[model samples]
Target: MSIVKIVEQALKDGYLTSAMEAEVGRICNAASELSIEEYMALDRLMGALLTGEVVVLPRKQFINVMEELVLAEAIAKVAEIEATSEQNLDVGDIAAYALNRLPPLYATTEEGANFQRARAKEELQEFISKQVKEAIAQSLNKPEFFPERQALGTSSKEEVISQVSNLLQAYAPEFEPQNDQGTSSS
Candidate 1:
């Protein structure tokens, strides 16, 4: 909810675009809000509903929400930097609040640091990385994956227009952009 508030305000105050706000909201909606412990437990939970623990399947929605959460942090970091002065930056407060509320990563060091890097944290990171990599691998096969394949490096107007024209021909054959004549047709 705080993320939603931040994005909405950012757009209203002209600091963020409406499209960017919507994008953040969309990603946030897909994420699951679990403390570190809860998330770890889900991996070991059995029968899709582990005993005494809530086993959450990665739902279609969580992905979007997770994306939003990621974007919100990035946007917040940017805002913190542009805050005009130290008095305007609420970044530290927000970060501290989130970290404080997060479940204490199971076995911590005697010094109270979660830096037992040899522990569950590594496994968790690996699991998450695998999940993301798999998602991208699947997306690569999608027909719309590279809709503007040649748009990656076009610098001049002619080159960019040519790339757009190719994409339009493949994706929107029914409609013709007025710039069709402007192309060299080579």
Candidate 2:
């Protein structure tokens, strides 16, 4: 079954919420080689993520189910950092260290670094927001799933304004890329 289908079933099974299903859908689209066959693990993992349930899967199966294509160790580290952060470490420190030791996705940009504190939880929010936006954008590709009301969800002026504000806060890129390092196109 497709990840979406699996997620929907899992949601019905009391594993996850509709909102979380929507979020995972984005992550699924972001990945490279992940296929529909292994979504059961994702449904389980996401439930774990949202509820702070510790999950241990067979090594290969864990990697196959994760959305970012994160390796077993990396997933372990994100989980570890998240766990340790409350007592002795911050996510930036962990992520910075991770950047050096791990691959690009965890390290790519420090866009989420400063917000990694337990109280603020910025990095997690950033990750979720990005996934949400990406999922919504990609859903547009399927007319059946991305019906007009569902796709935009902006039938009123106030809703539109709120949506735009929320999107800008969460998903809007910071700069349009420097044309010549000193100058901007805008």
Q: Which candidate number maximizes lDDT?
A: 2
Q: Per-residue lDDT for 113-141 in model 1, tens only? A: 22332242344444433443343333333
Worst 10 residues of 2 by lDDT: 61-70
Candidate 1, residue 83: lDDT:
67
- After TM-score superposition, the amount by which residue 142's alpha carbon in candidate 1 deviates from its true location, in angstroms, is 1.2
Stretches off by above 4 angstroms in model 1 are: 1-120, 145-186
TM-score of each: 0.18, 0.20
Residue 186 error for model 1, in Å?
A: 53
RMSD of model 2, in Å?
20.4
Compared with the true structure, all predictions reach lDDT values of 0.38, 0.41
In terms of TM-score, the best-performing candidate is 2
Error of 2 at 92 (Å): 34
The clash number for model 1 is 13
Look at candidate 2 and give me any clashing residue pairs: none
